[model samples]
Target: MNRLVTVAEMTLRELVRRRGVLLLLLLMPLTFWLIRRDSHVGQSVRALLLGISWAVSTAALFATSAARELEPRLRLAGYRPHHLYLGRMLGLWALGLAVSVPFFLLTVFDANNLRYAGIAVAMLCCVAVAAPLGMLIGALLPREMEGTLLLLTVVAVQMLLDPTSSAAKLMPFWSSREIASWAVDHTDDGYLSRGVLHAAVVTALMLVTVAGLFGVRLRRRRHLRHAPLV
Candidate 1:
């Protein structure tokens, strides 16, 4: 448990040290939020949520890719696979929440009569889903470019699709949109319920997938057995 916390803290330190990357990541969501600031409040907020999801997932992708070589060494040094991945996830989730805070505050000041709580829930869903989704891609695709392209494609499809379409529900960030609707449009509780359900299911699925992949990759092999000493 302490090891996990230590790994998470170190991961946070590493991200904080990359000042340029953190700034760029922060700029994206703010840009999206501000782009529609004058035209439509809902659009700006939804865009902001999308950008937040993208930023965190991209960070997760790069973080996982960067750690690929280092993880084996960490394993040799007595860390388990969960210690590495879960700790990294903890760091990424904290980073995601930090990135989200200002945008959330933006809604507080910039918009009126909004269900701010719903927006907060939507953002939570984004952070919950984005990290594992990105990690899964990073785990499956060895190259950063491949993982990035795949991530972009998913977000593109998500943007272009109609939210009511059955297909949009398949997108990982759909819950954010649904909950955003509840937040901005004053839709009934059904939207919030569906969004929460989707977020839960998707989060669980992605987590299981990531754990399975990590377990397989980090497992001990039979050939390296040690003989008992006399």
Candidate 2:
């Protein structure tokens, strides 16, 4: 238990040190505020939260502490790779929620819109889901430069594909535009039932997928250790 806490704290501190997390959690929000300064407060706030989620997800992927260090050092330290992976995910999720609270408060109280409150909640869930997904990618790829490229490629593909298109709606973190449109077309009661459920299911699936990949990596590492060298 103490080890898990230590790992989580270490992961958060490492993320903070990278500076990318700051840019994502701070600068991106500031950028949205600057560009949309004259826009309707509610709309601007919603856009701000969306932008924050995107940046946070990308930054989390690129700033993973585990990926930055050599696997040999990690194995040598007697750390359980799965625990370390889970701890990193836990830390990153906390960071995502930390950045999200301001956005939620802004939408709920300052923006004077309960709908945006729902949207904000949904976006926070997206960030929570995205953290492990990002970490899984980071673990598999491990190189920051390559991981960044891969993250960009995946985001680009998701944007182009529009998982919420008429055919499919199960993609992890379906974009804000899709959610907003659903909210507009259907009443809050109807949208909540469909949209929130979809989001929750997708989020759960993402976490599971990430855990599975981490398991696979750990198994491969153990297998390599037992194999005879040529």
Candidate 3:
């Protein structure tokens, strides 16, 4: 609908206008990739994936938080809750894809013998998981400070966890690591399958959560009934 597109376009414009934040978002993954460039090829790629995940999620959180007051007004002005959430989500996805492209090219140029398709898939999975996760966090925690601290804690645990542990799969970016393994090491089809499955499950759950919360938060009031005018 035109309403959805308008909200999405407005969200995109706001995100673009934050030039400094956009630069920092793009820089984080590049810096991470460089940090492990000398350590090991796989390390750098995995770090880059994680960086991308963190950057996208953080951006989503900020976007959702920044729009908290604006959304209710939009809902009052003929916009539905789903329209607001989905539009914002689409904008965030576009932003995430924009950020991921350069890093994907870097992997193509800097790394050797990588399954390029797998690398792209892993980055997609990272962005897919991160956007909803951030929106859900923003919905649940209204305060940006709290949402950010929680995201930092989650990212820290994700990086520190043993990949072989069952617990690792619970982390939002686990798919990034698994698919990165397949890309860099030419692992079996199992890695790709597991990564894809994990991403689907997490993305579905987060989207549902965001939808439910937004529906309730922006629902029309029961007590303040509007009667038809003569």
- The most accurate candidate by lDDT is 3
Where does candidate 1 clash, by residue pair? Answer: none
For candidate 3, give the lDDT: 0.93
TM-score of each: 0.97, 0.75, 0.98
Off by over 4 Å in 3: none
Distance (Å) between predicted and true CA of 37, model 1? Answer: 1.6
* Residue lDDT tens for model 1, 45-139: 88999999998999999889989999988988999999988998999999899888988898899899899999999999999999999899999
Error of 3 at 33 (Å): 0.4
Can you tell me which runs of candidate 1 are displaced by over 4 Å? 228-230
Give the range of the ten consecutive residues with the poorest summed lDDT in model 1. Answer: 218-227
Error of 3 at 50 (Å): 0.7
lDDT of 2 by residue, 126-154 (tens): 67767876776676676777877876665
lDDT of 1 at 219: 87
Candidate 1's displacement at residue 9, Å, is 0.9
Ranking by TM-score: 3, 1, 2
* Backbone collision tally, model 1: 0
The better-scoring model by lDDT among 2 and 3 is 3
lDDT score for residue 147 of model 3: 97
